[model samples]
Target chain A: MTKKQLKNLALQSYTKDLLDQKKVESVARLLTRFQLKQYIRELRNSESQKTINIVLPHLPAKTDQQMLSRLFAGKRIIYHVDKTLLLGIKIIDNDQVYDLNLKDTLDNLFTFVSSGYD
Target chain B: MIDSQKIIEQLENRLMSFGVDKKTQNMGVVEKITDGVVIASGLSKCFMGEIVAFGNGNYGTVLNLDEDTVSIILLGKEGKLKEGDGIKRTGKLLSIDVADTILGRVIDPLGSPLDARPKIKGARAMPLERIAAGVVEREPVNTPLKTGLKAIDAIIPIGRGQRELIIGDRGLGKTAIAIDTIINQRVSNDVICVYVAIGQKQSTIAQIIDRLKEEQALPYTVVVVASSSDPASLQYLAPYAGCAIAEYFMEKGKDALVIYDDLTKHAWAYRQLSLVLRRPAGREAYPGDIFYLHSRLLERAVKLNKKHKGGSITALPIIETQANDISAYIPTNVISITDGQIYLEPDLFYSGIRPAVNVGRSVSRVGGAAQTSAIKSVSGKLRLELAQYRELAVFAQFGSELDATTMALLERGKRTTEILKQLQYQPLKESLQILSIWSVTNGFLDDIPVESTQRFEKEYHEFVSSRNPKLLETLETGEKPSEPTVTQMEKITREFKKIFSF
Candidate 1:
């Protein structure tokens, strides 16, 4: 819905997963609880009309369950598919981006092209 | 009261343990007082006033070693003596601490950091008495170092890797020029500047720091100060320590410039230390290795080949001449060692030429290539005009009939002198003022009166500052004055002359 809502959802989901997996004894001790509560409250209030549009060359190898798990684990992410990515995946999110695609690899093909061999 | 036999036995045992040869050692007894022993001997000459302590686990240098009774240097503390004073020998000489972290930082003569920063990071250290650069390894200087001084740049250019000795009497602007060169290098990150002040007053050194700070030149500058008040050992080490620090950057293939504020005091200090250390004396009571000492120091300044890190050490060794005599021993020796010299004349200085650089005698061996095209164009004519002016000005003084050519030459000479009369300790970025002066000299603003020069210079700089400041940078690189820049300068000078004449 809103960026704030999404961030809170991601954090709450991640914290629940960590608790379920026994990875953290208490999220309260590990993170600032007051900040988290404030963030969640802001997200609930702002959830109605917020959306983000993203573009990517190809779908990732990870399943939806794995993707959601990662998103909950503090991975801000967006993705899409385009044939230009040529059989590889690219992800973009806040500040952090990952590109693992054939198009990026082929960018250096000009050097090989100039030498007249492929 | 004490037995002579026991004292002799103890002294012999101590000397043997400390590795002193008996032949080199001679001992005699002084006042055999109840308190302790005082020995004085000829062999203890250099070792006098030194003290050594043993058996209590602490060993220190002999501060006061008496030579009267002991044929060897006496070693003991001032208050540590008792009735039967037994003397021992410590065969080791004193040494200084030298390390790599000494560069890019200000340090006292004793190698202590004055910047109040932590101790230097690098490990290797060497004594101050180091050998000079070797001749065979040193490539001839070919690159130009632009001082941005129009008179100097046009007439006697300083090459990039050249060792140009700046010799003048005290109170002349020898150090001012050197400091200006350091400031000019600030825009070019490629150049590293090191300043070594040997036997200068502490107050002068402080003022230099303040000037560099005002110009923001200290980040790239490394200052090595062995003040007049420092120990002789420290003063002797100042130049070599500077060279060692410069060598670190040179090995990295970066170009570095080093200025020895003055080397005469360094030489005298070394001579004193050598005499005290029992080194054989030569001319003027200096050590035999005096020439070698200077040669080795100059040799370290070299321009590396391409295969090596292409680094350079351009040494500006300042020497103070007494009564303007360049024929003096130290001056001549240094003259022969350096690439060329910038000779400042006291007479010219008194005549109000601030740099007072005697263009007729001053020469830069390799600054030809470094001259900007504009400097080369104006300088050829400037030198001839000044030379003719010198002769004519003298003749004009004798009530001789004057030709228009001689009058014109005199005017040009006055203008040239005025152009070079920069304020003492001002940074070189202010050279646009000089550029404006040159424009006026070149007939761009010939109608300006003699008294209006300062007013004209200030107005011209303000005009340039408001209009196109980039012209100043372009001018410094020796580019020909552009049409617009020339027009603007002329307009400002003409207006200033009108205002000032009123």
Candidate 2:
């Protein structure tokens, strides 16, 4: 498989179980083979551009009013309620990132696995 | 063959461009000139580099400083200095580059990579400054940082974000424990580890790199090395550079661990530079700020509050005590600065405590909160039993033992000693398994004879191995052993004791 195909496969495998089966099938049908190929190509090219755009997850149990206010605050950022990113919001632009989530920092700190005395 | 006259004329022209009031201290004493660098010394060593450009006033940054007397850092091109010439300095020291990327990768004290990898890849660099963490921002350590070694984890618990000093004589596995901690981080990829080698052998550093590579632990680990062969200036900055690298991760709200393999050499290196810089010396000819030097470095290893993303920098500052004297200046200063200490005893090491950690006095002031429930439950009893055993064993050596309880305590002590005597280089996971097994085995501790307890403990381990392999699996992952698992271990130990009645 091509690199694009592999990346799509990996992404699909990671996110597939999260979506409802019918929704996944519908989403898959929305993108034809040619569109899928184009999407893959765009993702691959964007990966090499040294710039990234990331959507941040909303705070847990945010009120609808608060959500609407944040969405239309004239800022070029948006928050979606994706539980997979844990409890934080991350915005990636250019080569910099703005992380407003507690989970990311906790995750990074907890990732160390060495076992000797320090 | 360049003429001295031409060289002097070029020098005069360069000096004139700098607007310097040239006194022409001595003229017409034509000296043979070689390369661009000039070296002439009558009263004192003088070095002159080609004048690259003119600076403000009579003082300007030259292209090159005198090669013999002063080393100059040059910027841009147009400069002239002959092989045999003299240049006067404005009594300024050259500046060196310092950065956060200097951590993890094996680099000379001068910030040059010794591993031959590409240069450091950080965007920001800073000068080495001695700064301490602020009082209001500093918090008491409460989180336990497990080392996977029972002796250390149970007795001398190291807390997350604590500065724990490991003090021992040379060749007592001080660096081994530090390296093992770094390697153990592989089990939890969330922990970023940095190992700083100060005044260590280059080949020794190379071996450490090889070991890390073998374990595939290098990706998340950084090695900062300052060998004895490196210039004193580099040694002086080694620990600061290591801390800076750790700070990069900490500021980003990540937990980072840095190990200063030993600080004795770093102190000596700083002393050398201090003397060179004309700083006054104190006890042992070290600068008066020697204590402050270490305190500031260690204080930087802090745990930020939850509001600031709750990052932590845990420092393992190793110190080598001369002849086991902990009261020495360096040792005492480090002991007071760190959160706790792991005191390695030569006698215990000879008695086969692989880590040689003297449990009687070594402690982690705040690490008790971080231990697993199972460890906390058993560790208190274990320490008490071991202490009693030591006291009794000493009396028994003089043929004074007379009671069944004393004999039982001695037996339990032997078994505990054997269990704690882990083999060298046993990965953290294995050590944890062995420790947990010893902790939960109550049957083995109850009736075993003091003389044959070591043998019984060995047999008990063999018996458990034959009965259940999952015990090892759970320990390898650092997961708490389930109640059922503990019950199974207890049952197995009981059955083994019944089957192999002494």
Candidate 3:
């Protein structure tokens, strides 16, 4: 089947609030192995679009968590601690990164200074 | 000397205004490394020619963008990138850092010093791939960019902002002509020069650098080297980087000349990049845009109007052809793109004619407009005499007997050939070139034996220089010769001819 048709099939397998397990199983059995892999990837992409990933140097306290949760209401918020950031938060929405980290700031300053003074 | 106090104040102001804010970067993860090309996905916002920062001072320029991925040829020696390394967009195009201080230094395509000198200081960045000055910004090429070679100045003249190709087979003094032209600038015009050496051996480039230094021409010149050992990405960008540096000076209202010493290797570098990127290869395994690669670079050679800065960039792009084939793909492409070509022949070169310029084939589409009035006044007769000689010499080779008129034409042709034959690195002054050509074309040199023609020329030059300095001073003013000046030249020739011993 064409990829567009398979995409429609995968879309129909989902119910109003969540995916229907039996409907997904029935559509999965109709797809070939390659198409099944592509369908799963598409579903993963669509589901990830519902959340924002906030990467930081360490876990946030309750007040900051509540503020972030309130800021991005209805979407799932995942927190990841990457110590390379040193401090501050990075909000990754799809392919774009909203970088407010100490590393980027230092890098930006270094780039500016070197480009000017060097 | 740096303005340390002023820089400190500027730094203080920057620190005071500095604030931590969120900046956006559209990034991607490297999917694979194929023949030094990084295949990446998800930099959907990336533009062609944008720099992708791989962190730690390593970078790549975006060369290809497809529906799913982009391909970038890694630029420098730091190529230990992993498959999952994330590369971020710098939002900056590829550019070269240029300053007036960059003169006399040898730098790479990235504008990094390779001459063991300090980096460029307080420079402005000029984009390597700039949209050429449009029609409205350009004026017609009028002023001369003299090569100082008699054959070139008299025949295939190059003007400020003109694109003149120097094409020939190997070992035929192609680089010699370019070096001579660069060296000539030190004598007149004070034109700033940039020489881009792409895919040349280091030793060859070193010798050229030494030669330029020996002649004291290096002070007014910048050498941009993307030698054979460097990555193809650097080689591909070398000519553009050189052009950008020259453009930097031109923007400051200074005249500049850039020589791409053989662009054939540049085409090979682009083809290598394309094949590695998996772009569909077209003619002769070259990518479809092969013509555009040179066309775009050469199109940037322009003479800007006064409404803008009246600066200009004259391009002398050399192409080394195989076996003297001018009909080859790259040769034809550049020949059409340039205003004209100086067609050097292997036949003439091996026949002991140094700077073996074939005048019958070499043409300046910009023509006498770029020639000084002094040279233009006498070059016409020299051309006819040479053309007649060239045709008659072929017949004489058949060993047929000829009449007096033909014999006279043959004699004049031989003398003219001898006069045009200049050795390596000895470009003549403009008025001197005119004087030599006028004497030969006016039948003053007809009685001088072909064997002694060169010696006769030497004495004639010394006789004038040691005696009639005012005559040369007048010709140097670029006026067409007046009646009295012509009579004086004729009188001097007659006097010298009588006093001379064969």
lDDT of 1 by residue, B297-351 (tens): 8877788765666678889999999999999989999999998899998887887
TM-score of chain B of 2: 0.75
lDDT of 1 by residue, A1-118 (tens): 4445445543544343232323223433454666555444434322211211134554545686376445545433445568887755554322122345567546434323332211
2 against 3, candidate with superior DockQ: 3
Global lDDT scores for all candidate models: 0.63, 0.63, 0.89
Better of 1 and 3 by DockQ: 3
Best-to-worst order by lDDT is 3, 1, 2
Query: How many clashes show up per model?
Result: 32, 30, 0
Score candidate 2 by DockQ. 0.00
TM-score of chain A of each: 0.36, 0.32, 0.75
Answer with 2 or 3, whichever has the higher lDDT. Answer: 3
Per-residue C-alpha lDDT of model 2 across residues B1-502, encoded as one tens digit per residue: 9999997785565444443222221111112222221223221222232221122111122222221123322221214433333333332332223345554466654455677776664345443453655666666666667676768877777777988899999888888888778777777677888788888898898898999888777888878777777655556667887887777777778889989977999998777655644457899999888998898889899988776677889999999988999999999999999888999989988866788988877877775666666566567777777788777878878887478877766766777776676555554454344444464345355555545654665566677666766665664454455787667766766677788766
Candidate 3, which segments miss by more than 4 Å at Cα? A1-51, A61-76, A82-87, A110-118, B1-22
**RMSD over all Cα atoms, model 1:** 31.9
lDDT of each residue in B1-502, candidate 3, tens digit only: 8799988998987677565353988978787887668888668899998999885568998988886578988888646788878888988899998999999999999999999988998789999998899999999999999888999998788999999999999899989999999999988846999999999999999999999999899999999999999988899999999999999998888899999987999999999999998889998999999999999999999999998889999999999999889999999999999999999998899888888999999989999999889889999888888888988999999989999999999999999999999978888888889889999998888888999988999899888887788889988888999999988888887888888889
- Reference-based TM-score of each model: 0.62, 0.62, 0.90
Candidate 3 TM-score, C-alpha based: 0.90
